[model samples]
Target: MKYLLLLLPVFLFAKFASNESCKSCHPIIYEEFQKARHSHASLFKDPIHKAAWLISPDYKKKKYTCAKCHTPTDEKLLASFDYKQTIMPDINSTAQKDGVACAYCHRIKSIENNETQNINIISKKEHVYFGNLKDTIKNPFHKTANNKRFQNGNVCIGCHSHYRNKYGTNICSTNEHNELDSANCVSCHMPKVAGTPSNMKKRKQHAYHGFAGIHNDITMLSRYISVEILRGIDRFFIAINNLSPHALTLHPMRVMQLQVSVIRDKNVTNFKSKNFVRILGVDNNMTTPWKAKEIVKNTSIKGNEKRVSTYMYKLKKGDIVNIRIGYYLLSKKVAKSLGLQNNKKVNRFILLKQKVFIIKPNSFAPLQQ
Candidate 1:
């Protein structure tokens, strides 16, 4: 029957197909995907995820509800949780290693909204995958359908939007408005690079698969952010413009910092650095993800926000002002608790943007390069 024939390919792919299967046809994309954060999203592969999971409440019960987003390819792992059963994740399985596989993402038909979090609705038509191509190209492996969500990048909302703990406290949220009209996640994260989507077609450029983010390709993503300095008589304003659709930071663990220094006569005068973070807490104090009940403090820059900070330092002519904005994957306090205090990568202050401005005589603005 036609139905059985359609189901046959799905059954085969579900059991046999891995990312390796796509290598022969889409070698370039497959290589790029291997370097993506989605590929190493699992706890076993991602150190931060593993550390966080080990401390989470679900770890003791052997309930991996996070697998729904972290190891999405592991249907068995997800099914166990759905059945209200506790099962250890198979550490060696391809699903565990693959994390968010290409097949899993391409099959997403819709996103089901819920208070706890949004859910990804996989296509029942299994063999058919969705894409944003203007014209449908026949593929030997499966069928392709044009999806408006994929084209506009709304498809990413299923995982990247927000998360709230069982204690009714919002832990992490990228958007306060919960609307896509303000920003496009796809255009910023998956910008077109010099390559074709697949070997089956020839094109000048294709959507990058590395999934630019704080971990993977920070430089590429930093292009969306802008920094400006406005000078005054006794004070100067430094403004950070977040051009992205979501907050400057998506995770509560992450922290952004602004450092300013003035160089005069070869002597460096460092001003106090300001850190922007969203601190979750229980009662009135900072707490972990599981115990958090409310936001204690939030100084993070919002989506499409131009945040300005006024510095009262007086500037002299010919004084070189250095302004730098950077971030850390985790705050020093959180990193210490997570046993990542010694981690160079986590503790490293990743500079996003830097500017050197020299105060000019008689001119209100500095001579910036």
Candidate 2:
């Protein structure tokens, strides 16, 4: 009878609980979250691993660690607190993507209740959000009953500061092994930097969701006019090479690659990945990536010429074409290194070029080259 009672409510939340509950009013935050590093697409897609099989009978205990560090919120989703595996299919599936989500934070009872207790106490806030998980926008009907916990740093400390019990235990003094840190994770990730908002009195905006790491700068830029495309009578071209050496430094551990394509009758995509260039290096290498379009046509650099590559295309009329430039960065260990994980500025690059056309529309049409 006792076991039956516990099973009853577990079934209820499973039926009704969702992350969309909080996304209702947080549309922009929700959309940016989909592309965040915590997303499964980035964590699970990684190449490094400790032991894939033979360690534990459960795959969740092994392969799912990536999700924990990348998207973990509650213990059920994580395998172990020390390594990345502390994750479950259900919780990891949602909580990880939310990244200090509304439900995860709103559920906090005290600053001390962050991630220490296994207990999930749900006290709603008046204007607060809930865990809907379905829609990206927050629902007014789902306002959390207001609580004092929301007024302070306790909200951010809960998940950011945790204990690594699977390995051993330690006094709160130690911050290693992913447990509680000497300074809370927010001390660095969301540093208390001052920013002057418009005409308002200089107010602190907590640290903001930017987190200020990896390709974060680039990610924020994508929300606006990051890419500009112009299709000509012959070849389709894009002028989105905004990475400038002078802009900011690029993260070392990050591998930035750009892909360019052109097709006949939108055939650009049908064909193979036309041409690509990968600019993977430290901040010092940032300035080297920029080169004028004229440099590519040069036969050879006799003396001290920094040679760069290009993706050139020649298209004709009535030909469908597609051009895509995608950018992705590494987090976790990568960000953890170079002190970037803590938050530092990296270098960036800027490029300029013209899409060349081999033939005129009236003169002749080229198949593809």
Decoy 1 TM-score against native: 0.92
Q: Residue-wise lDDT of candidate 1 within 116-230, one digit each (tens)? A: 7788888877668788776756888988896666766778778876788888777778643467633567787888889777788887787888987777777887677777777
Give the lDDT of residue 31 in candidate 1.
Answer: 91
lDDT of 2 by residue, 280-344 (tens): 22332321111111111112111122223333444555444343433334333444432344433
User: Which prediction has the highest lDDT against the true structure?
Assistant: 1
Q: RMSD to the native, candidate 2?
A: 15.8
Off by over 4 Å in 2: 1-11, 15-17, 39-100, 111-139, 144-150, 162-207, 218-369
Best by TM-score: 1
User: lDDT of each structure?
Assistant: 0.80, 0.36
- CA RMSD (A), model 1: 3.9
RMSD of each: 3.9, 15.8
Worst 10 residues of 2 by lDDT: 287-296
